[model samples]
Target: MPEYSEKVMEHFKSPKNVGEIAGADGVGEVGNPVCGDMMKFTIKVKDDRLEDVKFLTFGCGAAIAVSSMVAEMAKGMTLDEAMKLTNKDVAKALDGLPGNKMHCSNLGADALHKAIEDYRQKQAS
Candidate 1:
């Protein structure tokens, strides 16, 4: 296995926003069967902004670390700002992820985006 960055290890050992938001404005769940890595992201919106964000993840250390990082990145941002977040941004926030585990970590951002989309769809209908 590849060695992880110090930041990655730090987040993995003590992930933040590591649970669901009760009555979340939006919730998204995603998984990679091949890697057996799964993630769920929940969000609360206020005035078109992400007032809060949280996540639950199962898999490797990288997955947990990325989930934490994504939540930190999304919180307190406008929906448009949060939507601009990308996998690369997630990885960079974690100080970078192991090459072999990049794909697993990438799911964090995808899950968050999905939750935001879910929230938007609900608002439209």
Candidate 2:
């Protein structure tokens, strides 16, 4: 049986940053067709700082937990700092995830990085 951390369960039940930003500075979508996990993250940045982060995910419980945690971690961070976010950090934030769910952690980090990259592209254009 997979034992889920209490923190992960809590975050999933009452997810943070669950909505969408009307005019997001960046938006990123990623999915693993093999596992059928999909997540879309949107960020609003101001003064190079991550003002807000939101996500919509279609996956298992682990995916929801990871997405919620990522949103909470990204807010108030600078774009560079947010970019540095890793799957390990997210797993730690959740008090640790099951070994089988490790990919969910990676998915969250990838989505956030993609969103940051989108923001950078917008700035460049």
Worst 10 residues of 2 by lDDT: 28-37
The C-alpha lDDT values of all candidates are 0.90, 0.92
How well is each residue in 34-122 modelled by candidate 2, as lDDT tens digits?
Answer: 78799999999999999999999998889999999999999999989999999999999999999988999999989999999998998
In the predicted model 2, the residue pairs found to clash are none
| Count of clashing pairs, candidate 1 | 0
Residue 29 shift from truth in candidate 1, angstroms: 0.9
Window of ten residues with lowest summed lDDT in model 1: 27-36
lDDT of 2 at 17: 91
Candidate 1 achieves a global lDDT of 0.90
Write down the lDDT that model 2 would get: 0.92
Residue pairs with colliding backbones in model 1 are none
Q: Roughly what TM-score does model 2 have, to 2 decimal places?
A: 0.96
* Local accuracy of candidate 1 as per-residue lDDT tens digits, 31-109: 9656679999999999999999999888888888999999988999999998899999888878888888899767998
